[model samples]
Target: MFKIKHVLLLSFTIIALTIAGCKSQFEKLRLSNDTGKKMSEALKLYNKKNYAKALILFEDLSQKYRGRSEAEELNYYYAMTLFKLRDYTTARFQFKSFADTYPTSRYAEECRYMGAYCFYLESPKPSLDQENTVKAIDALQLFINFYPKSERAAEASKYIGLLRAKLEDKAFSNAKMYYELGGYDISNYKAAVVALKNAQIDFPDIKYAEEMDLLIVKSQFAYAKNSIEERQEDRYSEAIGYADEFAESHPESKLLAESKELRKDSEKGIANAKSVLAARKADYEKYKAQLDKEGKKDTTTIKTPNK
Candidate 1:
């Protein structure tokens, strides 16, 4: 047991010393004034997938080689190292910088695409904030416009499609949330209708078109049902209109039955609202007639003063 313990300790110490020696050698190269050797070592590290070390060397060499012919190469490798290290935020900036600075370089187009791809990588899920998703879409679209005939244009377009889908999902989720909250605040039904309509206008080819259309019908119906008696007829009419549009547009939709029911219910609500309004009008007429009779009696009872 004692011999085994001694061997383990010796092995661990040797491994630690070896690691420390390698780190020391790298640090010495990094701090040295030998730009050429640093560049070579950085490239070697990058090729070996040692991006942490490569990034340090490349960062240092970038300053030293700035404005020189080798700067472009160093910058390209530096950005690539950052990308390989999964530092998308810095990698994207570096890639964009490289593309802009070396517009005529053979790697410019590649760098531009890579920069946009980094944005795509940074895009959060649909339930989260979508600023990065929008930026990614814009960047990818710019890439497509810049290189319409390039092979990567197709891939960029595909990525744009994916990002747009995510945006659609976000929009749908938001509108649906308003609809779901309508029970708490009836005004949310109106909000849901407006939101869903705007989403339809924004994304004419939205994958959620059928669902949104149904939601619009449902929201309009709910909005009308919760409105005041005087406004219910007009609102229910609007709901019926929306339902008709839904039915005509989505003849075979699975939600067709629900839309039809909403239409029927809206028609019933309008009828009920009209009946209530008519009763209220009759009561108001009776009250006005009583006031007129009293005014007439007072007038009759008044004796005109002699002029």
Candidate 2:
């Protein structure tokens, strides 16, 4: 048993030493002054999916191969290596630079598309900041502009649609927030109306168009309901107007009945507001009549001297 264990231990140690020796040899090759060997080994590592090592070696080789005929392929591979390592920012810039440097290269078209795709990958979630999303849209559109007849144009257009949808989501959410805010600070409902209107104009093809119109009508109604009595009539009239437009535009909308209810509510609100104003006006006129009667009584007594 002891001999068996000893043999096993010896075998394991030898295997470890062999691996260590191979690693040392690779290290020597990687750090050697010979750029050619590094180039060969880097491609090997890249093919093996050892992207971290491949990226380091490729970055080193890029400077050494500058202005040489090998520079074009070197830069292209270097950018791809960065992409493999998930360094999207640098990868995108490098890809763009490669396209500019070698526009006639067969890889140029693919590199441009890859640059835009990297930006698309960097686009943030819809709920987060969308600067990257907008950048991605612009990049993809530029790709299409350059390669209108290319097979990748269709794919680029698809990505643009996705990014624009994200923008639409963001705008819709912001407008909904304003509507829900509801008199929190100085006519948020009015702001909601404006925002929804702008969003509709900006994204006419949005899926939320019907929903946005319904919300606009709802917001106008709420704004009128919360206004002072004198302004409520005019504001509710505006709400009614919005509801009518919505009904006309979205005849088949699921919210059509609910939107018609908004019109009904606004009409009731206008009538109630008018009633209150009329009551207040009648009270004011009665008080004025009392004042005039008292004034005339005093004037007549003074002129007759109580005789």
- Give the candidate number with the greatest TM-score: 2
Model 1 deviation from the true structure expressed as Cα RMSD, one decimal place: 6.7
In Å, residue 6's CA in model 1 sits off its true spot by 4.5
Please write out the lDDT profile of model 2 over residues 1-307, one tens digit for every residue: 9999999999999999999998898788767789988998889999999988888788788878988998988899999988988889999999999999999999999999999999999999888999999999999999999999999999999999999999999999999999888958538999999999999899989989999999999998998888878888888999999999998998898999999999999999999999998998798678778878888432222122110
Candidate 2: count of backbone clashes, pairs at least 3 residues apart or interchain = 0
Q: Which ranges of candidate 1 are over 4 A from the true structure?
A: 1-8, 288-307
Q: What is the lDDT of residue 249 in candidate 2?
A: 94
TM-scores for every candidate against the unseen true structure? 0.91, 0.91
Which runs in model 2 stand beyond 4 Å of their true positions? 290-307
> Residue by residue across 1-307, what tens digits does model 1's lDDT show?
9999999999999999999999999999988999999999999989999899899999899889988999999999999999998999999999999999999999999999999999999999999999999999999999998889999999999999999999999999999999999999999999999999999999999999999999999998998898888788889999999999998999999999999999999999999999998998798678778878888432334334221
Angstrom error at residue 68, model 2: 1.4
Q: Scored by CA lDDT, what does every candidate get?
A: 0.92, 0.90
